[model samples]
Target: MYQVSNGIGFYVLATYFLAAIESKFLRAIPYEIELIPQEEYRSKFCYSVAECRASYPRAMDRGNDFFKYLLSRVVVSSVGGIPKYNVDEDTVIRYMWDVHQAAVDVGKSQLSDVSFYSSETERDFFMDFLLAVEFSVATLYRPYINSTAEFLVGFPHRPLTDQDRNVLASDVTVREKAFMSSVKFFSRTNEATGGLFLTVWKIAMTSEAGRAAGRFLIKRLLLIPSL
Candidate 1:
């Protein structure tokens, strides 16, 4: 789920980019607001809606390269953990800005027609280019997960019976059922949810606050017998 503030930031940035494209000029800003340092901006995580709104113009003023780089890092950090990070707002905003800037820059140099959205082919190409850049940046920063061995150990080895297949194909939520089955299968051989929950629990146990939070969450999870 997107944080409300981040979502607002994304909308604001998208509008800004569209405006920049339509006008053929970047929006001018007041001279008083100082530019955020690249490293600091890259590390800054938006924790609230206000922070996201406050930071939007500052990020935009830094230009496309910095924006894109910061965005790529945010995406990487967001997906490196189990619960996943809430960085989508920042990612979407930066991504739109970068794509818009690229289109504008290319239209200036290569096309006789200055408008980027003029040609269907050009629009398609830019869309593909945007996805390609996103993939490339994500791959460059994606963290390595060391769970292959655990996954193999946890996997159900026996061939599925007709009943099992029927249950899998039923109207029930397939992904949730499959995940639950895997956890159950893993628990048959080892404690915890096929080592996944175990790993998280172990990590949580290392600190007092973590342990307290983990216990609270575990209690809540236990109340949900179906889970």
Candidate 2:
């Protein structure tokens, strides 16, 4: 039963990923925004695209080098039987800001494209880019999330199945309480859905080329839950 249910659970997640949560957001970007000459936008922004890209290399680093490096040190320096340290929450938080900055830079570059859109297009594009950047950055934390989830898998408390309810019914701990809170949070339907929908609405209403880039991003993010 465990194996079968686990297999079904994995397929459920796979079905979500095939929805292309990230790719859709990338593709949603209107072509006019992409057509903007890199040189012209960079000149106006006073920096090159290379610099912009390099600024957030940590977020782009898929090998998890930074995370692994830190985790190794923590594991090696264990105190007593415990790992002795928690994952650095700062890394994820800082990366979020870095991703947002990248979005701002990309959105700003769109203004130089004179034929990009009608009068109101620019503002809309900026919002879309901002939200899109947010969505992209959010995906970057997937690793940390996976780590946290894995930690929960082998947790002392057993599954929430009815069979184990009696075992945990009379006992509670901070860890257990925290786990319950997290489960309750995720169990809520339409939480992410409504938020993404609002983001999509913002993008659709935008008129500028930059804003269109943003809209493209939001549209993509909105597909994540469906994935």
Candidate 3:
């Protein structure tokens, strides 16, 4: 039998939390990160976990992008002068890797179908997964912001024009805001429809129209049980 429960709310929360993390982190960066090697910039975040880890072991091993980003900031701050917007090659590389990893993690956790049947194991897995995701998202902010600043200030040479920087910052802000808003709604309820929620978020982040449509549908769906 299909269970219509509030389990869906939990998924919403987790999704928004994830998006919040992204938004906060991106805002922290003073400049936009150009995903070096266009081929590496697949899926916003890197999708191939194995390859991502292998290629950027340092970032993966750190387990917290914020911390790494922070450390980079501390280094720059210590240097005491804002040079051109030239970030070091390694620093940029690592940043790109972290961004990719975030994308991958989100993708993996994203729900494909809303009508999920709960086997005990799957339920437990989802719970654990959400918790892990939450921890990762919450703990890394301060460090990531600090490090991002360091990287941007100490960049080896200024690669981005003022216009480019502005554009990147704007783009990141929009993305982060949209992602977190959806996640906030997702987190407040409990249901086993994570997959469905993920689909909605994906659409919302894609465009203004998609976001309006997604939110409207969600509100309508939420009213069904009451009606």
Candidate 4:
């Protein structure tokens, strides 16, 4: 019958459309992890205090010991005046999941808006979403030095030195400076993103460990400025 043929055609078209949408969604999600080798990691270190100071002059001058403490924990290497830190795979996955959830929340909120359905608007939104995801991931996992003194100084390598103790000391000045620098950096980042970064900061700050870390680095090692 004519009615049966029309129903079959509609169903086929609907199935194809769903498949296309699913493919697009999968491509939009960001889950790739690129690991750096030990040699490559060591190649990125600044090699000396002067190199670190030169790489992040302002942080050295203004960031204090807490900054150094954070630096010591994560510094895998220095790249172009910036200290790059290693992020664990689990941490990177958690960050990506958080970003993805935030995107979903935003998408859901705007679903009823006319602009949400517009092809041009949707395309722009998707592109921006992908970009934000990429920036977040890169910020978290940039390659760095894997020196024995920095990340693996004690356990797998030599014992901690006096210099290491000084660097890791829980000095009050360091903590205060770190807290202040974090506030300033996150404030600026949120302002730049028109409050987008604020949302992410809030979500991250909810965890006790995250809150402690934020109180320390404001968000993470990313708060440390280059030059």
Give candidate 3's error at residue 163 in angstroms: 51
Cα lDDT tens digits for candidate 4, 114-222: 3323343233333333333333433342223642122112111122224332243343244333433344454556669997875776577556566555444523433
lDDT of 3 by residue, 1-227 (tens): 02211223322332333333334532565543332323522332332334435543443443345334543553433244643333554455445445544444443353323324244323433343343233222222123575435322321121222343223334334433333333334554324565554554554535546545644554333222221
Q: What is the lDDT of residue 155 in candidate 4?
A: 16
TM-scores, one per candidate: 0.19, 0.24, 0.21, 0.21
Residues 192-224 of candidate 2 have per-residue lDDT tens digits of: 676765355445444445444643443333322
Error of 4 at 222 (Å): 33
Give model 4's TM-score versus the native structure.
0.21
Model 1 gets an lDDT of: 0.37
Q: How many backbone clashes does candidate 1 have?
A: 1
* Descending-TM-score candidate ranking: 2, 3, 4, 1
Off by over 4 Å in 1: 1-31, 34-116, 141-227
For every model shown, the clashing-pair count is 1, 13, 27, 5
Q: After superposition, how far is residue 89 of candidate 1 from its true place, in Å?
A: 24
Model 2 misplaced regions, further than 4 Å: 1-42, 45-90, 102-106, 109-114, 117-126, 132-221, 224-227
Candidate 4 lowest-lDDT run of ten: 151-160
Candidate 4: segments with Cα more than 4 A from true spot:
1-73, 119-227
The lDDT, on a scale of 0 to 1, for candidate 2 is 0.37
